[model samples]
Target chain A: MRISVDSDRCVGAGQCVLSAPEVFDQDAEGLVTALTFAPDPGERDAVRQAVELCPSHAITVHDHGQGHSQGRDHDHGQGREDGRGHDGVVVDDG
Target chain B: MTGAQPRVVDFPLRRPGEPFPPPRYDDYRRHPGLVLSYLPNGNRVWLVTRHEDVRAVLTNKKISSNPDHTGFPNISDTMGVPRQEQIPGWFVGLDSPEHDRFRKALIPEFTVRRVREMRPAIERIVEERIDALLAGGRTADLVADFALPVPSLVISTLLGVPPADREFFESRTRTLVAIRASTDRQRDTATKELLRYINRLVAIKEKWPGNDLISRLLATGTLSAQEMSGVLMLLLIAGHETTANNIALGVVTLLLNPAWVGDGRVVEETLRYHSVADLVSLRVAVEDVEVSGQLIRAGEGIIPLVAAANHDAEVFTCPHAFDPARTERHHVAFGYGVHQCLGQNLVRVEMEIAYRRLFERIPGLELAVPVEELPFKHDGVLCGLHELPVRW
Candidate 1:
């Protein structure tokens, strides 16, 4: 899974770092910083929970789903819910 | 959705000490959509109760939290006209731009990193308070000796109340909360003195800065001195009891659920479960908006009940029960969107330290009064304990 954080959108509540410290860290200003661009599969659940818990929706995830378009689409407002499953970016076979 | 008129219930049905958001909160959520409710003064409002709907109402820019708005739900007549006139920097009662200005100036001070750095200091405060609490006696009111002071001192530290002035700050805050008996005149004096002290603190931070909240806020230069004072006052006063009550209720909650006492999930669950400021998120819709298949027209009062939403059965299984092991659900307890509680990280850390330390140090601690007789503050903006009597 891929992860990203928007410093501009961050409210500094720190839910992301609190929920998934292995993958995310806050910058000196307290905005979120992605410690790793891609996290181990074991860390996916924690990252997903961080995205869900983020008050500002500052975190986004993209699963390596079916040959899909890949663009750094952080715009268009609340880009986290970009068609991937709300729980995670996993695509369904059905 | 056919032929269902918005159901009516008394808005803010006050069932104090009954665990706020009472069972009736379910009545609104159980309905397919928002309900029409009336405030005590007969003002009609749209009460958003479902978890998703509450999140929507808070996040939507069309909603206004400003008290001066045409449709804003004024809880009391006293809060009506004079609110816009008097209070300047209380951002909790403000909307964007005006609210954003204060939030922008103060956000850096409350970042997760800043609060993380504060953990050790917070732990020290908790330890000192616990040491004092234990030394006082085996039997004492936990609220008076423990719950209240821990947060009060921590907040003072955050606000740059130096150790020398800590006693003065505590006494004034205690007076403000009526934890100590004082006449209205005395309470008024306490308010003036605290404000005066805050002004002095701001001046000191301006001249000789330190690594504290007030100093950092002055460094921002984004807020005027008046606005700076307003924001600090809001943080000191508004930020105090919410955590204190959380600690008080968290103590009672943990005592009842001893096995789950020290778990980290317990903190998040406690926040969601009690949702102390149940109806604090009141708003007015600025533009037409649709929520859960219902349309909220502009200039209409609205209340997105956080307590009710936190307990929504759809999001949280067995909604009313406090189960740390229950799959944690993201709750709107600190609220959602631009106006989400800025001090959430601080509150989280304080509770974590307060609960873990208190229980670890005093393993034999238990409630002094029966559950039925405990004093719960049911009839206020904050639903918390009036006093938490306990024994070691």
Candidate 2:
């Protein structure tokens, strides 16, 4: 598994560091820095959870073994990508 | 459902120094995302207890933060009145493009990197306050001597307010946030005084720029004088008040559970357990939305009962127990989504350093008075001790 973080989109909430400290560490400003590019098999679940829990959706993980990348990339104006796939779920009550 | 009398829960469900969630909060959690009636104005608001539901409503774009919106649940009669009467610069009460614009502009100043750069200064501020406490004999009021000064000075430095003016700002802020403690007249006077003070500060920054937040905003030229004043006012009030209360309350919690001292887990759990700004995440449903199987209609207010959600038994095992080792990171103490507390990272840094250093220096620290006799700030918007008397 390969992991990458978008610093531009990162707000430094520190969720990634809390979730997978071994694979991810934060700089002085709290942005994510990968400690190990290829994390051990045992750390994959945590890394995946970190990616899912990032409030800004700033983490991207490419699982080479599965040949798929799981993450979303969008502008700040776009709402959060919770991975629920319900982009337009909210509607006007009127 | 028209004429049905709702079950009324008092707006602030906990008293000062009380264990959070009151005892009956668990009963409310059983229904998950049910709407409960808030007695303050008889407004029916969706009380989201489960973690998932709280996160959903906070992140939902259709739920508006504007207090002017119809059905917005006002927690107190005096509260929200100032905003309703005039234009509000505090982005906490705004939504979308406007909220994002203000937040984005100020984000750089609070980023982890930026806050890290401010660490040395923050550390010095902490040390000075600690020094004062130690010099004033064995017994001291932690709230006034240590907790309050550290953040107050740090924010003062950030705003470039002269050291001479710190007392002026601090006294006014104390009045502004204490809702039930102060009358509406007192709160309003403080609000005006703060605005005038900020306006004068902005004028000073304009002529002689400095390395402070106000000067940086002035350099950008994106905001007008009024807009800049509003933003500074928000930062000044929020920056010190919440962190000061947390520091005081955190010390009390640690003293009670000394085994958790020096544990980072204690900080997160303390925030979750107390959820100081308990009812802050109130939003008005601008449009109909379905969240966790409940269909919330338009014009209805939604109060994500953060204290209750943090204590929900399903997400947190033994939710009421103050176990510092619990690793739940999804608590809504600082809120969630676009409106999440911008100063969270800064607060965490301040708190971690404050707690660790405090315990290390005052190894024999203990409450000066019995817990039952200590005064808690029940009349204020933030939940914390009014005075934490301690001895070493």
Candidate 3:
């Protein structure tokens, strides 16, 4: 599994770190950082939960093994990202 | 159903029982979309219930938190106005870019690391209050004696407010957090006094800079003296009131269900179960926004009921119960999106230490009065006990 975080979208609420501290940590300013981009399979549930729970919809994950790579946040879209498929992997610049 | 006068409901939905968020909300959650509701000011607002819809409303950038917005619900006259957007450092009610400017300058001071550094002090302070509580006798008002002081002193220590003036601010803030319990004049008086006091502190900090939030922010020169005062007012008031209320609520709720105490998740569960500050997350549609299949037109107020979202049965089973063992811990008690509670990490550490230490150190700690006799702050934006008589 591969993980990525959008620092710009991050509001530093710290949910990511709290939920998946092993895989995520916040900087001095509180924006999240992935401690290890590729978290162990054991940490996948935590990572997935963190992605789902982030208040800003800031974190995203790409699970290569199961083609799993989406968050409940983006799935709803809320008209922010046009044509963004829920099942499709979301890759953005930053 | 066509002409049913839009189903008017109280915006904050005045507290109903042992723990609040108004049970009327449970029915609102089952409805298809945002239910039309009326505020204390008799203004219209779309009540956003359900975990999914609340999160959507929070994350939607088009929605504005600025209280001055035309569509913003008029809640200020009752629950202390959110200080206008023109107020330089009143970022609580400002939108992004502007809000980001202030938050960026302040986030470092409140990050997990900075808050963690204060752990020893928090622990010491909690212990000291408990010591004082014990000294005062087995029975006393835990709200004032223990819960209030721990966060009040901690925030004072952080903002560089001198101990001499702590009482002045604490009293004013107590009036500030009340819902309908306090008259508009009382809240206004408190707000003015706090701002005036903070402005004076800014002048003092300028001449004698110290190692604290006010001194540090002023030294950065990012915000002016007046602006810094605005920020400090927010920090000082928000920093203590909500956390203090949570501390008291956490204590009382745990006393009601002692088995929930000692467990680490009690803090989170308390925050969720008794969603104090539920009504503070008010916003308006700056542009038309869709939530829960309904089109919320521009210039309409929105209340993303934090308490309702926390208690959404879809997310939390048997939502009303205080179950720390619940799997989904993602409650919106601190709100969501860009304006998420800046002091949350600090609040968490304070609560964690307060609960853990209070239960551990005070062996026989339990309520002095029965649960029904307790004074709950049902009429305010922040839900908390007015006083918790307890005996240890």
Best by TM-score: 1
Per residue, candidate 3 scores C-alpha lDDT tens digits across B136-249 of 887988877777778878887788888788777667776776544578789888888888888888889889998988888887788877778778877877777799899998
Model 1, range B144-169, lDDT digits (tens) per residue?
A: 78777877898899987889999899
The collision pairs in model 1 are: B16-B378
Off by over 4 Å in 3: A65-94, B1-12, B15-19, B40-42, B77-86, B163-193
Question: Alpha carbon lDDT of residue B267, candidate 2?
Answer: 79
User: List-wise, what DockQ does each model earn?
Assistant: 0.40, 0.18, 0.45
Best by the DockQ measure: 3
Off by over 4 Å in 2: A2-49, A58-94, B1-12, B15-18, B78-88, B175-187
Q: Whole-model Cα lDDT per candidate? A: 0.79, 0.75, 0.79
lDDT of 3 at B24: 77
Sorted on TM-score, best first, the list reads 1, 3, 2
Model 2 docking grade? incorrect
Instruction: Flag the better candidate by DockQ, 1 or 2.
Output: 1
Cα RMSD, each candidate: 3.9, 6.0, 3.6
**TM-score for each of the candidates:** 0.90, 0.84, 0.89
lDDT of 2 at B331: 79
Report the poorest 10 consecutive residues by lDDT, candidate 2 chain B: B78-87
Q: Score candidate 3 by DockQ.
A: 0.45
lDDT of 2 by residue, B1-392 (tens): 33343444555455655655676677766753465665467676777777767777777778888888999877766334344333556777888777766776676677656778889988988887788878899999887788877777788777889989988877777676555457889988998998898899999999999988899888877787878887887787777778888888899989999889989877788888888877777788888876666767788888887887889877888988988888666678888776778888788778888998899889999999998988876655567777889999
